[model samples]
Structures are given as structure tokens and as C-alpha cells.
Target: MATIPEPANATVQAVYRLHEQRDAQAGHRAHLGASLIGHPCTRYLWLTWRWAHKEAFDGRMLRLFEAGRQFEARIVAELRAIGVQVSEVDANGRQWRVNDHGGHFGGSLDGAALGLPEAPATWHVLEFKTHNAKSFADLKAKGVQAAKPMHWAQMQTYMGLTGMDRAMYIAENKDTSELYSERVAFDPVEFERLRARALQIIESPEPPPRISNDPAWWQCKTCAMHPICHGEQAPLVNCRTCAHSTPVMDGAGGWRCERHNTAIDTGRQHSGCAGHRYIPLLLERIAEKVDAWDEPGGNAAVRYRMADGAEFVNGAPPHFSSVEIRAAKHKAMLADPQVQRIKADFPDARMVA
Candidate 1:
């Protein structure tokens, strides 16, 4: 059983605060992760791949993530004690990897094991997790597939990738420190379906249809993409978020800028080029794009009319450039004479968020 954390002294509080600070500054994932691919919402997956929102966690949540990883090691030791032969590292001395889609999608296995009493001759993928007391009880009552489809999908994916027929899923109750284990059989149909979905999310230029348009839908409200998806905020400006950029056919998570005819390395993707164009769908709800025209050097000037009747142009700008539209305050600044003066006088001055 676990007890509540004791009241911290100044020194301990500083340590906790530092964890939160570090977590907040952590960068987003470069590739869509296999662990997250099991989520029900494809639009959420698409937005995440487009770098729509970077997740930040508080200190307690950060610590909980560390605890889950630590629990994996303990479970590995306990499994060995029970005569299950396990290997945490592959031939290259790394946790066995489950890779797919040219390495753009996959995750590290908790480990791989053999010699389970039920199937002593066969190998099984290992998946370890820690659940709260209530969650553990629910899992025990309903079994893994019905109780935790994400975990079930995760195991199926790992097994499918590694050519394993079975997986050993072990979960520990955080409150009671009790363990529950289940053996999962690979479902070929589900794994292929998941892989196809992942490919669709990685390659799409715009977000897939949202699971629900209603912001109040419980799932949508809790999603990280909620603000952008619901039109409360503009999508972040980056090469991946731009209409001109696309995933390269090459399996490596590489991107290409169609406007510039150049490959966009990760660094260039962060600070998108001047040619960046917002995919029209990004602003469709808040603003209807009224007109568009071609500019020199393959620039496409996009014009939009906000619901409130404010009109703005994107790239062929002596107007609001793609960068300026990112800030809600700047959206209303569109027809302001000062904006015209600034764009006219400085030619180089651009907005930053």
C-alpha cells in the first residue's frame, strides 16, 4: 500500500518544482508512437503528428510516469523468480523494439520472455503496467481485452511486429501492490487495421474528420487537440502544419516542401519558410477563405474572411502573413492602418508567437 506524500520542506518543494519545469520544457515527439496509436480518435492522432500541441505535465504526473517505468523492472525480476526466462535487451543491448512503417511508428517492448508455464517452448512479448486500485479491480473483473483495449491493441501490435503469437501483460495495483497477469493472443486483423490507421495519420495533409464536432463531447474536451479542433485556437505554424509540406514517400518520417521543392529537415520544420501556407481546412470554421492567387516565386496568396467580417490575406502579404494569424489578438489587427504601415515600412518585420 502507498501513503500520501509527506509535506515537503523548502528543499523538497524546490526539487518537485524543478521536475515540473523540466517536463514543461520537454519537446514533442518527432514520430507518432505505437503506444499512442491505439487511441480511438484518428483526428487526434493526425493533429499530434502535425505537432498541433505539445503536452506538458505537472510534477506529480511526471513522477507517476517515472514510477511506471520503475515498476517494469520490478515486475521483470518477479517474473524471473517464478521461472519465466526474460530478456530485457536484444542482441544489440537495447530493449527489444517493435518497429513498423519504415521506423516512423513503433515502441520499445517492456521485454521479451520465454518459459511461461502455460507455453514453455514459445516466446512471448512482455508488457508491464501499473494501475490504481480501482482500475486494477476493473481489469481483474473484465479481463484485459474488454477492460483495456488500448493495452490489448498495444500487445497485439507488438506481437504482430515481432512475429510472436502471444504476449504476457502484467499489471500491478499501485495501492495494494498486487499483481495481475494475462496472456494475450495476437489478432492479425486488428494489428493490420492499426498499421493502416497509423499510415493514414502520418501521411495526410489535413486532419481526418473529428470523432465528434461537439466540443462538449467528453472525449473532445479532454483531448490535447481540442482547442485547434474546436476552432478556439489556430493550428501552430510549422512546416508540418503548412499546406505546402508533406511526408516524404521515403519511410523515414521525412517531410518535403512542395512550394520550395526542397526536403524540410526537422530544424526547418520548426521555423517554417516564408512560403508557408495554411491548409485551408485549418481556418474553415473560424474564417471562410474568400480568394487565392499565385504570387512570384510560387507563393500562393490566400485571403480569408473571419466570421465577424474581418478579411485578411496570408502569404502575398503586405497583409497578415501566416505567422501573424497564429495570434488571436493579431487576427483583429488585420485592417488596422498601423499593420499596413508596419508591413509597408519594414518589409522584414514579422509576427512571432
Candidate 2:
């Protein structure tokens, strides 16, 4: 028999490349948005904030997103056809959004729905999701809260942010077209707990310890940030990831810097500033020696010797270059008297000591 031909590889490659390019152009988000608020691991949330990079979604995953979107549009159309009033986009052609109390966190809702049998003409937050056959069956059997706490928490947060008391959580099965829905009332207690937890993550200086002690744990194997979070790769530079920075009370009921003893604006916190330093955990594998030193006016420094045998006695070096340049810059910063004075004022400042 003649040799069987393979499928066209070029077409699939083109499709995958297009999706990859789109993913790259989207870039990383600066805020810790609502979708991730209910994730199981606090350490994962912290690592996300510290790194701010999305897991690389392959072509199949990207296509799944597109399918979910199409399903959303179809659901909206069906609702409209049934004389239900659902507006996915608001007056300005934008989705509805809400911010947390401190304005440090926020997210856009899917839509608002009205005239459901459960509510009888009252408006409620419309939260929609699509799942596969097995997942949808589980959702139908257990309902949202019992089967999926994350989705339940997300709806509660939406209600909390929008000051609404009710939300209609809808799920559709992609394979079977089966639909399941439940009206979830706002739980102030749950919302408050989630909100407080998110604030704690944003305010804490160091990330919470890893979720597991064993690197070979099942969860670790599936985690997208496994390499960087586990110290296999260098972490991205940011204030939250810095060794010398911690969030303190700003006194007006918001977060401030432990180092500067002042409120750091949101943008600076997200992207980092001139003073960014890699946290000690991230540097441990690469640093040869780290020492603690005290100066006048109650200041302290965690001096480091790079693996290359160069001495540098300061935090917050610029983008890494040759080991020699970074080491020399660190030495320069330590020698400056102004840097000395600046360090002295922050008695609360700390590092790996």
C-alpha cells in the first residue's frame, strides 16, 4: 500500500502562531482582579502579584476562551428571545465594573439580568460560565457552592462590590447544551472574608510560604508559575517582590510603605520603582554571602556577595548586568552618605536577616 499522508502541518502552525502572538500582545495585568480572588492557594495569588505574568495558554486553551465567549453571546440572545431583559454592555457600551473599598482592586462584571422567575422583575448580577459535560453534571448535582466554591465566591464578590443583594449564576454544558442556574444571595460574611484576605496578600511584605513542602507534589506539578515561585528561575522585579519593602498602615485606613513610611501610589507598587530589590529567597541560590550591618540613626543593611566573588552592600540594584557592574553599583550606593541617611530613617526596614 502507498504511504499515508499526514495532515497539513502548516495550517495548524499558522493558527497556533496567531494565538500566541495575540497572547503576547495582551501583556500582563497590573491589578489582582476578581477572577483570581477565590483561587485555592494564597501563595499562588501572592506569586501572581509578585510576578504578574499569565500562564502560557496553548492554542487549545485559547480556543476554549473563544468558545466560551461565543456561548455567552448565544445565552444572551436566548434570554432576549424569551422576553428577559439582559444587558451585557451598559450605557457607554462598556461592561459594568466595581472597585474594592480601597480602590486598590476591581473587576468588570459579565452583565446585569432582569425579569427572571426567581427575582420577578428585579435586576441582578448576571454571572455566566461554560463547562464540559462531566463538570456541568457535577454542577447540576451539587449546585455551585458545593461543587465550585471559587465561582460561588466570585458571585458573592460581585454582589458585594455592586451593592446588590442577589446574583444569578448560570452554567451551560458545551457538549450537551444543558443549562443549570441558581440564584445566590449576597453573603456579607463571605465577601468580607475574601476582601480581607486579598488585602492581606497585597499588604504583606513577603509572599506566603509555598502551599506544599514537597517540590514533587501533584499541585506543584500542575502550577504554571512552578519554576519561578519555587526558585528555579529568577522572579520579576517589583515592590511586592522586593526584600526591603513591606506594606504598613498609611493611617488613613490604607497601606503605606514600611521603608518610606508613606503611602506608595498604585502604579509604583505595580511596576516597581528605582528602589526595587529582589527578595532574599529569590537571591539565596545566587548570593555567596549575606550579612547584616547597622549604621547610625538606627539604619541597617543586608550586604551581599555575588556568586562571582564581587562585593556589593546595598539592595535595589538596577536591571542585572555583568555581575561586576551590579556589584560595583551596590558598593557605590552603600558608600553614599545620602543613602545612609535614607536607610537610617526607616527603622522598620529589613531583609533576610
Candidate 3:
């Protein structure tokens, strides 16, 4: 018999490239996910909620995400195979969802199940996860609560919202194919605390305080929001980060543009209007919006004072536009003392480039 032929290396490369392309086109999630609500950094949460940064996952990372997703389906199937009664979706055939804060904050649950040896008759919120060997070892050594507080918070929120008193967390080790399961009880106090944290993130007009002022903090170093949170980088341009826009303080999960007093759908939010102005705090490191610095979170065009003591406006004729301010973040010429004087003198001129 003839031996089967192996696929060429180019085929493998092509597959990864396709993954990269798909990720490149992926849009950022609109809601603040409940799964991430437990993260200790408030500033990171706010920046993510406000589209202060964009995700640029490489092909390898994208593939890892896909692997974890694939693992979830397998885990569900295996659980059902072992005589466990599992319900992965609600009546609508959609993944069970938990919504709060006017729908601005929520997450989709893995599933619910019954028939575990410890509590055969009771139902449990199901949480599935995949971890590498090192992470798996630590999880076993420390137990879920001590080693994975975020995961603990996640299960608590799910059980509390879904009306379950307990949760089953099952993690698979990628290296050894080892499995670890833990039963977690819901904490009402922790649930309420998580609820309050979500509300605080959704309602506040400005980004929440950073966990540390030091940029070198290890946690800060690994965060996606690192550049904008610590470095001099400006946030991505979008309505969510604009001075005129804000998340509605309700369960509507909607955004509003104060300048126009109109509802902003996700499409319009991604493509901010010409009236856009950077939220005062977003540019605090580069320039200060002198006129509206005292404004809670939103304000119209205003005066700006650069670090070198030059002045300019952010809106109307003679002042730079929001786009220009973002562009200036990249080009030194935009903030040059001489150019500021030129603009001050030409008051009528505009930087079109």
C-alpha cells in the first residue's frame, strides 16, 4: 500500500495567514464583558469599554483562541457523555446570557448541568476552561479560589444572575490532557460587589483610576491598554472616547452624543463625527483642555495649553480639530512651539495635511 502524503509546509503557513486576516477584520466588542468584570484594574476596564485601544492579535494568538473555543465544545460533549444532563442554551436556543447596567455589561455562560457525584440532583452553572501545564499545576496546588480569583468572580456572577447557588468549573490541561474540576458556591456579597463594580465602570464619565502610577508595574506591562494607560500614546479615534459621547446611565446599553443630543448606534460610534473632541483626561499627558478641564466628562470645543506653554483651540475656526489633535500625537510639528505661534498668528489657517 502507498503511504499517505503529508501536506506541504506552505499549507500550514497559509492556514495561519487566514486566521490573521480574519482577526484583523474582527471588530472590538461593544459591551463590557462580565467575564472581564473581575479584572482588578479599573482603568483597563474603562479603556476597553471606551474603545481606547484596538486588538491586534497575531496568527498564533488567534489560533490559540480558536483552540480554546474548540475545547469548550468538546468539554460540553464529554460532560453529556458521562450521563450529565447539560443545557447549553436557553429557550431561545442562544447561549445563556447575563446582562446588567442597562445591558452595557454582560457575558454568555458556558452552560448548566446536573448529575455530579457530589450533588447529583442539584443544577450548577458550568464553566469550562483550558490551561497550559504551568497554569494547571498552580490551579491544582492553590485550588480555584486562591489561584484564579477572576474565574471565581466569573462563576459567582453567573450563578447569582442565573439563579443557581453553585457552579462547576472544569479546566483541561493543554500539555498533559489532564482535567481538574472544582465546585464553587455563590457569594451574595461578592455578587453585589461585582454588580457595583460594573455599574461604576459603565456610569463614570471618565476612565477609572489606574491601578498604579508606575508604568513599569508588571500587571500594567501586560495589559492591552498599556500604551494609552501609561505611555504618552493617545487613544484610538472613536465616539466612545470623544468628549461629546457617553454611555447612557441605564439598562438601555446605549450611547449618546451630547453635542448633537442624539443616540449613537455602534456604527456611528466607530465612525465618530467631525464634531468629535478628545475627552479632557485622554490628552492630559500631551496637552490640557484648559477651558473644559473642570468639565465632568463632556465638553465642546475648547482652549488647549501645550506642555511648552503654547495655546490653541480644539474646535471651530482657527483651532485644530479632534482628528488633528490625534494626528499631532504622532507628529512633533503639531505641538512645536513655533508652529503653535504660526497658528496663533494665522488664526484663520487650518492644517489640512
Taking all chains together, each candidate's TM-score versus the true structure is 0.88, 0.73, 0.89
How do the candidates rank by TM-score, highest first?
3, 1, 2
Give the range of the ten consecutive residues with the poorest summed lDDT in model 1.
328-337
Among the numbered candidates, top lDDT falls to 3
| Candidate 3, run of 10 with poorest lDDT | 292-301
The 0-to-1 C-alpha lDDT of every candidate, in the order given, reads: 0.82, 0.68, 0.83
Residue-level lDDT tens digits of model 2 in 1-353: 99778777878878987988898767555556777888888888887866534578887789888889888888888888988899777778888877663554667788888888777778888888999998999999999988888888888888998788999988999998888889998899999999998888777666677788576788786788676665435555556666556544333224455655666655666566545556655555345336755445444445656556654454322212122222332434433456445545654432211
Q: Single out the weakest 10-residue window by summed lDDT for candidate 2.
A: 316-325
Better of 1 and 3 by TM-score: 3
Instruction: Write down the RMSD of all candidates, one decimal each.
Output: 4.4, 8.4, 4.4
Count of backbone collisions within predicted model 1 = 0
lDDT measured at residue 114 in model 1 versus the true structure, 0 to 100: 92
lDDT of 3 by residue, 1-353 (tens): 99778867778788889999887666678899878888989889888898988878877788998989998899988988989999988878988998887889888899999898789999999998889999999999999889888899899889888999999999999998899999999899999999999889888888878899888898988888887877767787899998888888567688998888899998889889867787878877667767743233443567777777766667744457777766664534665667767777887766644
Between candidates 1 and 2, name the one with more favorable lDDT: 1
Residue 286 lDDT (model 3): 69
RMSD of 3: 4.4
For candidate 3, what is the TM-score?
Answer: 0.89
